[model samples]
Target: MLLILLFFVAMWAGAQNALAGGGSFLTLPTLMLTGMDARAANVTSCVALFPAQIATGWTGRDLSRGAAGLSLRTLFIISIVGGAVGAVILLLTPPAFFARLVPWLVLFATAVFAYGSFLRKPGEANAHLSPRGAMASQFLISVYGGYFGGGIGFLMVAALTMAGQNVRIAAATKNVLAAVMNASAVAIFLFSPDLHLAQALVTSLGATIGGVVGARLLHHIPDKWLRIVVIIIGALLTLGLFLRAP
Candidate 1:
């Protein structure tokens, strides 16, 4: 059972990375169902996902030349602040608050994720964003990402579309933002006594390898079918969270 669960975790993480969304929608719940306590599951997933984010970010850069770099650096700075604030909240707030909110947030994220492919119009290939608008939106989404990253890719995609970027560019930026938020939260969680560092490390390694492979395959794939698959997964994830929430 453990081995099978781990295999599912790797494949799910790989597919989610390939699709440019965070895989916490799959990983977090899986970990919890496997008997990890909720907080520990969240923290462990954050740690495991860090390496995946790095791999995906590098892949995005390879695909987009310097464009990915520009967007990544911008999103990273905003995410750092947001993640730190969220970590503080997690440490201080009641777990019940977050528990009640996760399902609703997942639902909203799914809706946003579903419409992400259409956010930009035809021929708007370049990002025509004002620096101020991009920064502000990045900051806001970072807060959301830091708190709960289920559909953070969609939020970032929405922000990028508002800034007039194409789906590809939005995706690259989303990867960077997800990386920063997870990294920050993971760092904070490392000091916790309850975290299982060994399992987390193993999971992170799997996610990293999967992310690199997925990034390599992203451009060659037909995204319409991929998008449909992701929407279905997102809906399932959303329903699962709702059912699990207290």
Candidate 2:
């Protein structure tokens, strides 16, 4: 029954990834509810969501673009390197410490999402970021994506809007960049002691299905409402994590 529930949630998360990002906001907590430690759950979530992110990114590949002077190739390389560095940092952190830190991370992610979704004014569809700022922002977000990635989609949206991309293009670019960011982390986590293969596989199956279906439904779904729903979830999740017995 739990696994069944998890599979369905994974599907929702995958769909959310396709539509607005923040999939890990679902998977990380769901995985934790299964009794895995935070570090293990985080690792497993990263692996499980990788395929769905790939699918989502590929489906929207045509719309993706970089900042004014920064090419996609440059962003790609930055994501890879930054993600790897963050993954390495995660690898070295003590499990207990990470468990303690999960709540704070989730809280921060939730705040970022809220800002992007509600407070930030709509940007011009064609506004481009200054090249240097875009590159630096991409790297930092990549590092965060590799680390926790709960609200990465919105974070990318915020950054991309500054680079002259609209929400749609930002979503597409983030999907691709997200996949790239996780690629290096996945390589590192593939052999780690913390990964839980069974859970990861289950999520992978559900997320893949969701990614495909969600891509098709992207045009039909109300993105703002979905984001609002996700924000509510993130807030609740953040509170729950904080109140949870350490």
Candidate 3:
């Protein structure tokens, strides 16, 4: 029954990831409820959703180019390094410390996503970041993606769109970068004793199916409504995480 529930949760998460970026909020808790510790749940979620990310990114490959000042190659390299570093940090972190920090991290990401999605003017959509600033933002976001990954999709979209990409392209690029970053993290997590392969495998199947569905929706959905939906998901995830925090 738990496995059945996890499969559905991952399917929802994959679609959310493809559409906007708050999928981890659903998958993490589901994993924890299945008797995994928080840290284990985090790692397991990353691993399980990785294939779906890759599939989604592939479906939107033409749209995965970098923003105005950022090159896809540079972003890819940054994601790789930052993801590895973040994974190491996650492994080194005391479980209790990570538990205490989870809610706050989710809150911060949610607030930033809200400000970007709702408060930013539409006229400001072409606002461009300097090369250094763009790289730094991507690196930081990649690190965060590796560590916990709750709303990293929203973070990536916010950063990319702020850096001058259209929202649709930003979302697509985020999918690719997300897969890149998590690839590094998943490599690290594979060696960890905490990972639950059975759960990961089950979730992976559901997530892959959902990824294809969501990727198809990317081009069909209006940009304004897409952003709104992403923000709503982030807000709800924030509230849920806050309520769950000890």
Candidate 4:
């Protein structure tokens, strides 16, 4: 049981690092299937992802120079507001809405990631949206981010591409904003009844290790292959969501 659990955790870490989206979709379902309640699964996944984001941030600090490093203050402020708003929205809404929206959102995100090549220039830096607009999009994304971060990275990447930013800058900006969403959601979970602290801790440890490895290996990986695989997974997840619908 322990080895199996660790194996899943490791796989989750790799997926999280490679895609920056859909990591939770893989791990959370596994936890639920293993007998965790749905809410607990989300809480546990959030806990695991918190450290993973932190590790990514730390390891990628030097990579954020130039355009990516500019306007971080605006990004951070927008993220906080967006995270807070998203958290409140989650507390007020029923879970059914998320179940309905997730598939569409996943498919949209997948499309954006997969088609990023055709839509933007090769190695372009900050392509289309203004900094202010980018910040606003980040805030909006935080709303979704606070509830489920599955494809948040893809959304961020798209936003950055639309804004004419380079991939590295977009990725860096996405991580910072994502960290805000994760931190805020984690805080809410800490006080909520659904959290499983023990499970969260263990999963977090695994995610941390995986994040470090992912960050270190980021440059060497084939992003095109990774994006293709994630798109297929997202499509499948979307199909499941549709099938499960009434």
**Between 2 and 4, whose lDDT is larger?**
2
TM-score between model 4 and native: 0.79
Number of the candidate with higher lDDT, 1 or 4:
1
User: Which model, 2 or 3, shows the larger lDDT?
Assistant: 2
Q: Residue pairs in steric clash, candidate 1?
A: none
Q: How accurate locally, in lDDT, is each candidate?
A: 0.68, 0.86, 0.81, 0.65
For TM-score, candidate 1 versus 4, the one ahead is 1
lDDT of 3 at 93: 91
State the displacement of the C-alpha of residue 124, model 2, in Å, after optimal TM-score superposition.
8.3
Candidate achieving higher lDDT, 1 or 2: 2
lDDT of 4 by residue, 1-246 (tens): 843685466556555564444566566655655665544666667766787776666556665422333466667767777776776666565556655665665567566656663365565543566666766778788877776666677677777667766677768766766787778777776786667666666666666666666656668877676666666766776687577644
Give per-residue CA lDDT, model 3, range 1-246, as digits (tens): 999999998888777777666677678878989998778888988899888777777777888887656689889999999898899899999887787787787678667666765686777666677788889999998888888876677678878888888888987898889889999999999999878999999888888777767777878877677657756766676677678776
> After superposition on all CA atoms, what RMSD does each candidate show versus the true structure?
3.6, 2.0, 2.8, 3.5
> Between the candidate structures 3 and 4, which one is better when assessed by TM-score?
3
Across 1-246, the per-residue lDDT of candidate 1 in tens digits comes to 764676568666866667556467677777777676666677777777777677666656643311232455556667898887776566565667766776787678767777665464554445455767677767777766666666677767666765766667666766666777777877787887646776676677667667667767878878777767667777897787778788
lDDT of 4 at 3: 34
Predicted structure 2: lDDT: 0.86
Give model 2's TM-score versus the native structure: 0.92
**Ranked candidates, highest TM-score first:** 2, 3, 1, 4
